[model samples]
Target: MEKSAVYHRPSDNFAYSINKTTLQIRLRTKKADVQNVKLLFGDPYIWENNEWQIEEMPMTLSGSDDVFDYWQVYVSPAFKRLRYGFKLQSDADTLIYTEKGFYETAPLDTDFYFCIPYLHQNEVFDAPDWVKNTVWYQIFPERFANGDSSLDPKDTKPWGSEKPAVNNFFGGDFAGIIQHLDYLVDLGINGIYFTPVFKAYSNHKYDTIDYMEIDPQFGDKETLKRLIAECHSRGIKVMLDAVFNHSGYYFPPFQDVLEKGEQSPYKEWFHPHSFPLTGGERPNYDAFGFVESMPKLNTANPEVKDYLLTVGKYWIEEFNIDGWRLDVANEIDHQFWREFRQEVRSIKSDLYILGEIWHDSMAWLRGDQFDGVMNYPFTTNIKNLLAKQSITGQEFIENMSKVYHNYPKNVFEVTFNLVGSHDTPRILTECEDDEQRTKLIYTILLTFMGTPCLYYGDEIGMSGGADPGCRECMKWNEEDQNLDMKQHIQRLINLRTNERLLANDGEIEFLLPDSPNGIFGYRKYTEDKSIVVLVNSTDTEKSYSFTEPLSDIKDIYSGKTYTGSSVTLEGYGFAILNY
Candidate 1:
């Protein structure tokens, strides 16, 4: 046995309480190394006559990646406490594992076992339950719509008349969003995640000039409140984007530094490499990448921390916003985020806190910092397989397996899954204008675990590249829109909201077929029913044979009933089969 490859922890993703009583535990071993694993667990205090009451339960192989196979088991301790260990039997050796280390023999002492002294309900990773059931719509405030022409920027141009540029604005405002509430409601989206709407000089609003005020072009504080109220009246939730990692060059504190240099009282508010502030080809201090206009905030400073925390509290307490989508969240300090969570949750305990992190985020998702991060890895992997066709079905499963086991079940449920965003190319364009391929990807996204978000105009078959190109004006004219694509996405949204098995709580299992080319499949199942999603990502038609008898199969998309064991799909085809 390759014992060195084995890994487990008593807390976090490896083990966590799914509810008040039920605890889920996971173990990782080298791929194809262990033949079997049995969990040995019992309450630490449950001892009688100098013997601890223990029970042994076999663990099932849940998933695998390139290097590891993950095993999982669920346990509910009668006494609300747990002391557990694992017994592994491999082809070459047998061993016992615990919190301390691997042991040659099973130790009778409870101290040697992994411990969950008592499962405190408060420590549980509790994000809002509503978030898991939501379908989010991400709106770039500057490009969504223009309701009030009076609020248009001085240089505002005609909407959709020209391609987007770095310094151009199309007069999209809060009134525009308010004007389109019915449209969004018709599309069946319950949550709206708006990119930074605060006062900023740039069109995207990432560089924050004032965190307290909404951008003039986007409307004032009152306008935002009205928008939020309107959304709430229709059962929709509002989440505003916050950029606290840095301040724009025109921000008061940053401007003070530039004007008075070291003499300014707010000198410590930012990071300055030298006595005099300098901004040229590169910043003399820390900033967001190479942009000197956005000076990095000194979050460690007490004053700066207090100011940011106030900003975090203001939206939830004053405006009654549902959540905050933090920009460049990975760049901020852990302590600041912990305090931010405490302050914000103090007002609204159920408010969702999502981070804009593009990579591995296990550190920020331990039930303390963030409810979940933007699931960019999910986006990348899906793009590689479905859009680019660079990976096989088995490889996609392996990649997803790694992500599946990276966090506790609660965190995974709230993950922000998206195929395209303000930062990426449109989904249809990524699929080379192939509507079938785009629909297939959306099917997987909508049916998979986590909350799914759709970029504005994606449902109408809008196509563009990244950045300036992706931020196109919303096409409201039916003549300019693709009605078929819009209807397809609307149907998906309805299915996701109305179906119980499609919700975040469903158990998902990826089916790895023997054939590696063009086909990928998985099933979202519960004790009462199951839904299988299969997709063929190639140009040519494909055939798949079921490993077991699939009885009473009905495709939700096509309403085609199948009683056979095998099925065939047309080019770039897919199916959502219910059994």
Candidate 2:
């Protein structure tokens, strides 16, 4: 009926803008019989020229794959969604199974619609008047706090085996987080972003073991319901991390396939590969689809989708959460997400769905996949700019402008900006204990457009070098630490949360001084307010002067009064002004 799906990719769904420059194309299928597949395109519909005809751009895969089967095709780093597909020479004809063929993702899917009709209010892409005003705090549940020691992992636990390393087990349970919601409230965080609480094997819980049950070590579902209720009472909403990309090899159904082979009833739930290769002959299959401990699940399996949707809906229907922070998001099927986002809306129309994509939230922000993504590039750019010492203040502003221009208004308005996350060293350590510079980074994170995120212990000056190491327990004691760090953080956060002009809307720029190498300076303000941040990145003190009148803000810390643009800042100093 549709020319036998002349392309093996969802080419029809491929839509992008040249302003972003790059794009991506994704294809997923379990059939291992197809070989020597190559994608060819006639031409991209560049400029609706009243006709579709042009010489297409040609490209090839970076590596070789001769009939290799992938467990999943969650697109990684392929920036733009390209219009291309597989060309496999089948027996009678070289069949082209299109990605978003009419048989698969119908064009009627208005979720994939363009700008005007695709704001996705139901998916929280359409930010309400309330969302723009709230701040969020992300906590990996098991590492946050240990409120109930009684709930600690038992020897040879029922759900899964226990490991002894800090990551293996920390005994952090629901009661622990329940006990600390107030601490978050005190810190002025209006929302909580937690890692999964679902039953799983590893401590991180990325690989789900039991969909219906909560890990005993993490407390039962009742505890979760209570925590949600309590958080609501405190005016704080909860956003649970969603990690459905893959399941642990030991996950029940998958284990059934492992133990019973093709005879297993649930065997259809996964992409079959060389199984149970005992005798240690290197049992074949990409773990995490590419890593062995994390075998990818088949979200395309009707049963898998039905079961997972129920799990997702349960969280919203039961606990009334605000949204979801999808883990390893780019690794999911686009068709599946279109439905997933739709199903989530059936329960609650305005639930936020932020993907954990490092590259571009704009990739999926077309309104079909996710509302937002972790602004990794945003933070990483500044860090690289600082470390390389190659970028100037103006360069930083241009990069940010590029980011903002790529996404729709709402996404750019509510992105999550952070200095450090659970995966990296504390910003304090990255700054090498330069309290003044650390405070400047902190200042920029909040004063910028996105919703600022504070890693659990970063505010108190907790430092770690890398992964696992970055996840240290919270330290409450303030004695002997840099009092300046604590006070400075408090001031910045207060400004972000309480200042009317500083919260969401504002003009931002990095003001370069005459001595270009001397400082990293920026200014942010709306019609109602204005603040300037001048950072002396170097260590040795260097004095400098401002050229114009500066009277918009009363320096909260220095207790200084000024009404002239010509002012000066001390070395390593940052400022916040309201003008």
Candidate 3:
């Protein structure tokens, strides 16, 4: 409360630094109920198809105070702008605790997130507020659109085929995005969040091979310059997805360890004893994650921290990019993120940092590391409830309301909410292909609190089953889009950008139904106006008597007037009203 007693550096002057890619932490807080402060680092692994993949972080609290604080935990080889945060331990709240020990979410959604320090404050971090009051579109760099036919991969597979497979690249490149700037600007998207564009072997580029260079496939520096210049002229900001949690085996250091045993000078860059004694093979590393192709970089190494930090800052200076979306953000060392936020602000005070967080990230949102986090808790929760057909109207209201109260008020307004991203099935498909239900999903995303992001093709009625299936090429066809999907999305974006009441101020409440049926309702208002969104999750149309607060608004979508005591909604129906 009252912003809490915190000492923070001037946003303009702060920067995170690493010297040896090694670090030590000493606890500074006076509290003694100290269990162990777990030092965790890795990418925020995307949870899909019910699989969990994590990049392991080596812990070195090792009782050394000389290198770090008595409680100062250290990990290294950190990049200047890597995403990281802390997880603290106290006997008081046994439920859940991250470095700062705060959580906010609802039963409406079970997904949660850890808070980080890179959160841009409300002008507090000296970073100019993000071009707030704008719209964002998330583009999977490889699939959105291939503007240059020459750039299309010669070995690409057909989308959705079982043989060649969905994992194959579709040749979407930065130049492709540059070519479509006109299309996107016309659609009213002011910000673009491209999935990881760093050098990697795969189409997704999560296995970062080099942080400094944009993958040659994406385009060279010249292409990026033109794209950045054109986008800036058009008022569009490009945010690249930066993956810092691990490096591919092809990464120089990883390969060095493979080629030369203890003689390798870079041996300390990874988990100790991670390399095998024979053939200098790393049969495995301590990094207990999904696979070995992606070797977890020892962020605890001071040298590693310093190297990444320098690279992150370089991008801002080299290219006038707007910001970054940290991939697998949860797994990176906390020290790395703290230092990164400090440094990046110094480089470009206006940059925005978004983290890939699945859980309640309120702790990370506390005037620190990230300006906002991808709201998976809200996204997946809504998807699962709708898919299972068990979501209640009251449950919906209560769940979202909890989100409203979960994060710090100042930064909460800017969090990103979306119905689907590249990693999940399209919202329409996720909800069992029901057009009306997907419309309800639309209401939840565009009208709810925070900035809403629409996946590249979802607005045009793109459909798929799951992860690889959800990520498909953009449909240039205006007719194939289901139910005027593009137009509907345009309306939603217009509402978010144009309506002050809907943008920030809103009241979320559950209309407790007589039975346990699923029906959720929420309202947004300001001094001069109000907007209401009501959805029915059950098969049958739901009805309820009108009440004082809700009876006042008119349905903007249908121009229906409501008065008196009871109001009724058709089955699988939703109403958006304004008054």
Candidate 4:
């Protein structure tokens, strides 16, 4: 046994409450190093005749990746408290793992075990149940479509005619999105996550001038209400971006500060360091990354907190929006989010709260704050192996394992997983225009755990580099679209929505190919059915043979049947084998 590789924490991903009565415990060990694992658990105060009352149960091999095998068990303690430890065994060695450390035999003293003092229902991270079944379609509202030219901005250009810039608008509005409701319905998407749609100075709408109103370029409040109603009519959920971290330079409060200097009533609303506010090279106030055009708000102020919380609750109370994708949520204070979650969910208990965090966000996902953060780590790993080829297939699996283990199982299930968004290059462009590699990346993304998001135009092979280039208007012309890529994406979306095993909380295991050059595989399984997805990233024919002959397998992707153990795939090909 690799003692150094063994690890467990008291209360986190290692141990957590799945619900009010159900507690889940997990352990991580070096892959294939331990032959079996058993869990020892009991209520901390349960004792008789000076001896602790304990119970031992065998742990199941839950899943494995390149470097670690995860063991898990679910327990419901009679007293709603737990003190637990693990009993690990190998072919040649046996060891007891407890809170104190590893030992030759099980510790008789219960003090040496890990502890969960009590199970609190409110502490369990509960995201929206609908998110588990959702396939998100991310829309950059300004580029998605143009329905009412009458509502177009003064300088709006013809759709798909000009290159996208930071300041230019293509007249996309709620009316446009309203016209395309059937289009999204036909694409098999249940959720639509729009980039910032509040009143803002920029075309992207990230710099919010007002959180309470829809951008004039997008439409009026009633127009947005109609759009939301239409989306709901078609069984689609709408998630709007919330830019509470900062306000645009044109925002009324910031303008007042600039006009009246320190004497302004709204001076306390922002983080202005000096009396006379300046915004040339460096603003006197704290802003989003030194950009003077956007000023960060002082969320610590009671007034600011109330105003932001009202904004958070207003949409749910008014339009009945399904979720809010917070912008730069990591920069804000955690207390504000806790209050925000409480306030928003008070109106709609199951309302989804998503954050725009790019790194580890364990602090913000404790059920009192955001439900989940963007799964940027997954995106980074996927891009490295499939896009840049900077890492081998094995390296990708190891990195993915780290990501999987970084958060609690509940948090991992609702994470916003995506390959492309407004902040990144299109997926096809990331693959350097190679359709086959792009397909493989999508196969991995759509089939993997968590809620997957598809950026508009990615399914049709629209190619561009970052930011302004990636935000180009949607190419709706049949002559300009990649029909094959679109169809493949549609199929993947259908599989993700219909397959029970592909739920956010399914048992998944990564498989290693005999030759680990450019092949990767994983299986999503339940008690009823199992699926093995294989991707060959190399530019040559690849064949994989099982250790023993296998029967009763069907390829879901290509609709082919196989009865033998061996399978051959073309260069950059992918197959979903169902058994």
Candidate 5:
């Protein structure tokens, strides 16, 4: 037995309250090392004599990655607390694993077991339920459309007439978005995540000049309210970007600090290292990555916190927005986010709070701060697997399994999953303009767990590199768009909307292949039904045989019926099977 590989903890993803009464505990062991595991658990106080009474529940092998096999079991303690340990059996030896150390036999003292101090209902990760069913469409407002050319900024070019640049503007407004609400509806998008729409100096609007006012380039507050009403009327949800991390140089408060230095009442709102602030190769004061124009706000300040909290609540209270995607969320203090979540959610109990974090965000997702992060790890793995072709199918499955096990099931369900975004290269560009590979990427995205988001022009096969290149004007002409790609994504969204299992409804078990580059897939199943999604990343045709015989199997994508244990797919092909 590999004693070093056996691991468990009594908090976070390992042991967490799934609901008011149920506690789900998980254990990890080296891959293929352990033959079986049984969870020995009981209330800490439930003891008849001095023996410490307990019950044994066999832990099921939930999933496995490259290095570890994860096992899980759900138990409800009568006393709302638990003391648990594991009895792990390998081919050669059996050992009892607990908080203390490996023991030859189960220990009677509860002190040796891991403890879940108490299971409070509030501790259960609770995100907006509507998020799971949503399919998000991200829009860079300046490039989406030019509905009213009258609202165009000075020197605004004709829509899609030229390439995009950091300073260029094409006058995309709420009127433009409102004009195309039906287009998104046809694509089966239920949620729209617009990049910063607040008044700012830059075209991207990340540097907030005014949090309370809508950028004139995007139209007035009434126009935004009308857009929200139109979206809600059509069964769509609106999520606005909140750039509270920093303020633009042109912002009134920031300009005052730059002018007054120490005498400015708002000087403490920012992080100024010394008097006489100057901007050059590096700013004299702390800023967002030494950029003089974008100054990081000191969120720890009471006045700054109050102002931001008001900005957070004003949108929900006034415009009835459904969500807020926090910018630079990881850099901010956790206490502010806790208060942000409380303040915003108090007004709208179901308002979704998403954070823009590109890495592991377990620290911010403990039911106290963010409901979910941007899920950049999932994006990196997918891009490497299908787009870059740097990783094989087996490696992709293993990598994704690690991402899946990093967070609680509920947190993963509502994560903001995306492939191409305003910050990354477009999916088609990432796949080197190959429509087939792009289609496969969308297949994995829309069919996988969590709410998937499609970048503004991705469905129509728009291709561009990172940053300014990715923020092109939306193609309005059907002749200019890739109809096939659009149809393919539209169908996938339909399947996701109609089928509950596809959208975080059941447990997912990844199917690992023998060879590193071989065919691979995952099975999302419940007690009554199952869905097996297979992907063939190679150029030649590939076949995958199911371990168990499948009867009355139907391909959800093609609507073809077949009864068999094996299935074949062409190069870059995917199958969504239902039986």
Candidate 6:
């Protein structure tokens, strides 16, 4: 037995409350090392005589990555408390794993077991139920459309006439979005995540000049209210970006600090290192990156917290916005987010709070702060496998297994999954303009777990590089759009909507490949029904055989029935099978 590889903890993903009465426990061991595991658990105070009374339940092998095999078991303690240990058996050895260390036999003392003192219902990781079912469409307002050209900014170019630049604008507004509500509805998008519609100087609107007012370039508050109402009427949820991490250079508080230096009442609102603030090279004060235009706000300040908290509540209270996507969320203090979650959720208990964090965000997703984070790790793995072709199918599955085990099931389900966004290159560009590869990427995205987000122009096969290049004006002309790609996406969305297994309905099991570059897939299943999603990442035809006979199998995507246990797919092909 590889004792060093065995691991477990009594908190976070390792152990957690799935609901008010049920507690889920997990154990990890080296891959293919342990033959079996039995969880020994009981109420800490249920002892009768001298021997601590406990019940043993066999742990099921939930999943296995490259290095570790994860085991899980669910229990509901009668006393709402638990003290647990594990008995792991390998081919040649059997060991009792406990809190103190490895023991030759199960210990009688409850001190030797890991503890969950009590299971509180509030501790269960509860995110808004609506988020899991949502398919998000991210709209960069400046590039989406221009319904009311009267609101165009000075020097606004004709829509789609030229390439996009950092400073260029095409006068996209709420009225424009309102005009295209039917287009989004037809695409099967139930949630719209608008990037920064608040008053800001930049076309991107990440730098907030005023938290309370809508950017005139986007439209007046009435236009935004109408937009939100239209979206709600169509059963679409609206999530506005909240750039509370920093303020634009023109933001009144930042301007006051820059002008007054020492005497400014808002000096403490920002992190100015010294008097006489300057914005050259590296700024004298802390800023977002080294960009002098965006100054990071000191959210720890009481007044600043109050102002931002108001901004958080004002939109939901007045306009009934469904969600807030926090910008630079990881850089801010946790206490502020905890308070922000409490403050915003108090108004709308089901309000979704998503954070823009690109790394492992377990710290912020403990049911106290963010309901979910921007799933950049997922984006990276998908891009590497499909777009870059740097990683093989087996490598992709192994890497993603680690990602799946990182968070609780509930938290993972609501994560914001995206392939392309305003900050990254368009998906078609990432796949080097190959429509087949781009379609494959969308197949994995829309069919994968969690809430998936599509960039504004990706569905129509728009091609562009990162940043300014990705923010091109939406092509409204039917001749200019890729109807095939758009239809492919629409079909995937329809499948996701009609089929519960495609969403977060059941347990997922990734079918590990036999070779490095072999075909890969995952099975999402309940007790009786199952859906298997297979992908052939290669450029040639490939065949995959089922371990057991699959009967009554139907290819949901193609509406074709299969008779055999094996299936064949063409290059860059995918299959959504229902059995």
- For lDDT, the strongest prediction is 6
Per-residue lDDT of candidate 6, residues 474-555 (tens digit): 9999999999999999999999999989999988888877677778999999999899999999999888888787676889
1-579 per-residue lDDT for model 4 (tens digits): 899888888777888888889887889999999989999988878789988888899988866667788888889988788889999999988899999999997787989999888888778778888998888999999999998999899878999888888888899988988988898898888999999889888899888888898889888999999999999999999998998999899999999999998899999999989979988788789999999999999999999999989998998999999999999999999999988988898899889999999998888877789888899999999989889988777777767877887788778889999999998988888888988889888888888889999999998899989999999999888899999988988898888777767566567777766766656687887777788888787788888787777786888778988778788888888788887
- What digit string (tens of lDDT, one per residue) describes model 1 on residues 430-485? 99998888888888888889999999999999999888889999999999899998
Count of backbone clashes, every candidate in sequence: 0, 26, 85, 0, 0, 0
Determine which window of 10 residues in candidate 2 has minimal summed lDDT: 68-77
Write down the TM-score of every candidate: 0.97, 0.73, 0.74, 0.96, 0.98, 0.99
Task: Give the better candidate number (2 or 3) by lDDT.
Answer: 3
Worst 10 residues of 4 by lDDT: 499-508
For each candidate, C-alpha RMSD in Å? Answer: 1.5, 13.7, 15.2, 1.8, 1.1, 1.0
Q: Tens-digit lDDT track for model 5 on 156-243?
A: 9988889999999999999999999999999999999999999988889988889999999899999999999999999999999998
For residues 1-579, could you state the per-residue lDDT of candidate 3 as single tens digits?
111221122122112221223322222222233344443343343335754332333322222111121233345523311233334444653222233433431111112333223322242422235544657889988887676656656676443233213458767788778878888877778988878777888777777788888887778888888888998899888888876777876788878887886788878787645445222234456442645677677877889888988888888899888888887788886677878888998888778888888886754654458878887767766775576566665555445544544543335567777878877778778777787777767767777767778888877777886777777777766676664667776777776677656666643333445555745566666556667677777768877655564555676666788765656888777777776
Q: Tell me the spans in candidate 2 whose CA falls farther than 4 Å from its real position.
A: 1-125, 155-167, 276-283, 385-390, 480-483, 507-515, 518-529, 540-548, 551-553, 556-558
lDDT of each: 0.90, 0.62, 0.63, 0.87, 0.91, 0.92
Which portions of model 5 miss their true places by more than 4 Å?
none
TM-score of 1: 0.97
- Reference-based lDDT, residue 84, model 5: 92
**Cα lDDT, model 4, residue 493:** 86
Q: Candidate 2 on 281-364: residue-level lDDT in tens?
A: 334543454655577678888998888888888889887988888878788788888888888877987788778888855557
Instruction: Please report the TM-score between candidate 4 and the true structure.
Output: 0.96
Q: How accurate locally is residue 369 in candidate 1, as Cα lDDT from 0 to 100?
A: 91
Alpha-carbon shift of residue 458 in model 1 (angstroms): 1.1
